[model samples]
Target: MVTTRVTWDSLPDSIRRDIEARTGPLSSVEPVSSGFNSELAVVLRSADGATFVKGLRADHPRVWTQNREKAVNPHVRPVTAALRWSIDNDEWNLLAFEHTPGRHIDYSPGSLDLAKFVQSLRTLQELPCPDIELKLAEKRWASYTDSPELFAGDYVLHTEWSPSNVLVGDAALFVDWAWATRGAAWIDPACWVVWLIASGHSPQDAESWAAQIPSWNDAPADAVAAFAAAQAAMWSAIAEADPEPWIKDMAAAAQRWSESRRIGARSQTAR
Candidate 1:
């Protein structure tokens, strides 16, 4: 078994000290998923109850990323109903939020858990973010990826829609505020469906999951060619930059999406 090391001692002491000051001495620290950008730590405090602390790791330009969140969070505060606040170490950037309680559904496409994923993503799109740097969401995904029949216009920007990133308890709470922006709302769900289809799930299963989103009642109609293109561009970068096994999985799914689009288009023309 390959172990991913995430320990409280691995974080900067100065950062922990600052958290202690604010939350009033954390009693227990449980490291959660450190996905792509930050290390998620659930801190239980004596007086303050529970809080989430995301310690920014060095590699992925976190200071600028969190700074972007710092700028738009206030605007989205009322909309998302999720708190996003950044702390500065005068050298590094970390984000602290009120730990929303929920179950992190470990879902892939075709699972009933996909409903939570779609609802959470749509809610994020509904969030008012006039101050966000939309280009920040682009992340130059299209340039690296190749597909002759490109369909990149079916959604707002895809986020950390993977099952682990989504927490479902009282509600679907999307924790990662990074890589969020606007486009066609369907793009993210299409990406999720790709996850389902690739995970030994049939097209029927994919349709059931996609239909869970009322906006996507006609699942095939909702699966626009543009959505496939957008997903291909969005995920190809992760495949290149990270050594994570899931990235490889996404890359293959992206290519399959391209092929599926081509075949579907051709089948329609044949009629």
Candidate 2:
């Protein structure tokens, strides 16, 4: 569910002062509306430069996500906006990132952004999972599959592939590390396959595009099949609970990809 956003002026005076003290007296404040997770999302400008701030009330249920992003930031350098500073007071838990300039990526078939997007995935695929507190992929999907161990690995996984989480400028930059996980290197590309399908790629074509990431090629066939099935089930449940058009579309895409993988498995068995 989307959190109700708070305006810049709604913050307590003491909180505003604390932020300005770190940002050098904000000259301008613009609320950012693109992301859904943060109750406080804005761009602050000061004499020095601009900073992007996102936060939740200290007592918010998901406030732990703030700490996850902070712990993961140092490991995910130029591919993500640099973390400038963070604040945790009685009122709020906030993070400030260098203001990165870019538009969200277009995942539509034939768009030029595909190559850059895949390259960014390749960069992420090469990074080893940092020894930090991250949820294990197996545990995350345990309810969806009997063989959750198939998802285990030593690589960092950016499991969410929504177009909005990626920014395209001089290069593709991934944002929102709150859901980052430790999983098989191929799982990231596997996750992207669903979004690619939703963006008008055939299941086969989506898998082909995912093939651009070398790790995708190394994936065990059974593991990939299990992951695909799990995604289909997971998205279907989400769609059923919400019934939003976009959510239904994602559910359909995941189902299509899962069926395609099942067919491929049967074909191999028949041979």
Candidate 3:
């Protein structure tokens, strides 16, 4: 569910003027009904074309999220919509992006999009982490992990795994880099495993799909288990706080994944 939203007409006249100055006159605005952040998220259609814009007020507590998205855009442009411009002045802050034409990815078992998604992850894994400072996975999950060092790695990660965050077009495009993190390359695929499980795949099936990404395959089992436990705790807290259906489902999926990992480790120990 959209946590907050603002329509084009509701924006201050000054903000509207600033936006029009960047693009041509806005002929139409289409609000996108996805994402929990962003006070505004809409496609502004002009004589030239449509540009997607999502933003929040400067005073908002999570305003840093916009900065995070802007900073990582260039690094992930190969698999993301192009960032055209940004307005980060006194009152309003916003970003305009190349209006990507695509629908949310379908992560069901045997979906054709799986190959493209995996390729995107592989390509992303190869890029040098951008110089921009970001929240490290180890740091972000320090409280949840048995040892923060278990989360260490040098790979950049797009930590969100909601299907809505991905778009299927000429390629599987990952949108919303707001939560991008610097950590083990395998973390993103590990996060996706939870979503895959939430989307109806068994925990075993989810791991199989994740193993297709070489980093995930090469990752140490203990490190992955550490992440699984942390993720389960994180989702459980979110579910308890809000109790949204999606949140609860994902929490359950994460718990299931965590349990499976524990069971597998025991089996190996038994042998």
Candidate 4:
């Protein structure tokens, strides 16, 4: 299991004293891992209850993802209300949020509750995206383009999509909103299929998952292969550059995604 380190800025004696004075007494100032930002402090004060304080570090590749998503996400209302709320408030250059309690989705590797996952994706797509001026998210897939072949068709892709990125709870709460971008929505679901395969799940076992979205079966096979290759190359670079210990499995998953698409293509041709 990967254990993430949580840390916070040193509270000044004045702030501590103010907190103590306002609240009856001080409790614990524990750090939470809701993000990979400057610092995330889950300050729990007996006097004022709880607040998630996020310290935003300027000029971070990671934080830029969150800002980009949050800006355009307002166009995708209720499906992304939590996001819209954050952007509209403009509350923090370095910010704090009220913590809402929720649980992550619990599905064994390869056995995704895909029905719900696809529904969630559709909901995100259905959201009305008004014209907004958010900077476009950086494309994660590049290695596949190294070959002489042309790149995949126009797609607003999220290079990162796995069970880890999605935190399903009372309302399919998607945490780690850093990788949000415009891309072929198919890439996300195909990425999931790649993840399932690497974890020792049979494609047939994931038939329920496969059945959940006809789009998977219907999308052009070449597109699927391109997406898988693009996604794989993207994360491999990320892992190599600044490895996030939690994502060691991603490299293998990317390979499987690319391979699966190839196998799928061969089968299509055979018929």
Please name the candidate that would achieve the greatest lDDT relative to the true structure. 2
The better-scoring model by lDDT among 1 and 3 is 3
Candidate 3: lDDT over CA atoms?
Answer: 0.90
User: Could you estimate the TM-score for every candidate?
Assistant: 0.75, 0.98, 0.98, 0.70
* Tens-digit per-residue lDDT, 195-222, candidate 3: 9999899999999989999988888899
lDDT of 4 by residue, 1-271 (tens): 2223434335445444543454447577776654443443455556566554444434333556446665654454343324312221222233334444554554455334555566766665445434543323223344355531333323333334455455565555454444554544455456566566555566545434644655456556566667667767866776787676545566666666677667877898999
How close to the true structure is residue 150 of candidate 3, measured as C-alpha lDDT? 74
Model 3 Cα RMSD, 1 decimal? 1.1
> How good is model 3 by TM-score?
0.98
Instruction: For residues 186-268, write the lDDT of model 1, one tens digit per residue.
Output: 44566567777667565456646766665455334534565566566656766777757777777777667766777778898
The local lDDT score (0 to 100) that residue 41 gets in candidate 2 is: 97
TM value for model 2: 0.98
Off by over 4 Å in 2: none
- What ranking emerges by TM-score with the best candidate at the front? 2, 3, 1, 4
Q: Please identify model 1 stretches exceeding 4 Å from their true place.
A: 1-7, 10-13, 39-42, 57-60, 72-81, 108-110, 136-139, 144-158, 211-223, 226-230, 233-244
Q: For model 4, state the Cα shift of residue 28 in Å.
A: 5.2
Residue 154, model 2, lDDT: 90
After the best TM-score superposition of candidate 1, give how far the Cα of residue 93 lies from its true spot, in angstroms. 1.2
